[model samples]
Target: MALYFFRISQGRYSGASDQPFEFDSREAAWTEMTAVCSNLLSGISRGLRPNSEWRMEMLDERRKPVFCIRLTADTLD
Candidate 1:
């Protein structure tokens, strides 16, 4: 298993995960990240702080960013 970190950023507000999660592979970690992003988006839709620049960054054990998922509120007709 390997350790991974998730850092959340919403505009000027940012926070880091206090504990790391263990995953067997990067693919697994990516899957988890998607779930997390979905939850956060739900919160926003439910009257949580709406942020146009909300994003989650995935980092490896060495603290290097592997990928980032950005969420934006765009109006569609």
Candidate 2:
């Protein structure tokens, strides 16, 4: 097993898991990250403001980035 970290940023909100998750492999970590992203996307089902961006970053035990997923929202009048 390996230790993994997850952090997120959206507009003025940003946070990370205080405790790391132990997963069997990187694929498993990716799965968990997607689940988290799904939950966050649900919150924006209503709508998003112009120039809004959401990011989910996965880090290793050494705090090095492993992978990142981004979602951007824009509105034009």
**Worst 10 contiguous positions by lDDT, candidate 2:** 42-51
In angstroms, the error of model 1 at 50 is 8.6
TM-score of decoy 2: 0.81
After superposing candidate 1 on the true structure, give the runs of residues whose Cα lies further than 4 Å from its correct spot. Answer: 45-51, 74-77
* Cα lDDT of model 1 by residue, 1-77, tens digit: 99999998876888878799999999999999999888778776564354366779998888789889987765555
Candidate 2, lDDT over the whole model: 0.86
Task: Please estimate how well model 1 matches the true structure, expressed as its whole-model Cα lDDT.
Answer: 0.83
Candidates' C-alpha lDDT: 0.83, 0.86
Tens digits of per-residue lDDT for model 2 on 1-77?
Answer: 99998988788998877899999999999999888888878777456677888888999999788989988887777
Q: After superposition, how far is residue 54 of candidate 1 from its true place, in Å?
A: 0.2
**How much is the lDDT of residue 66 in candidate 2?**
94
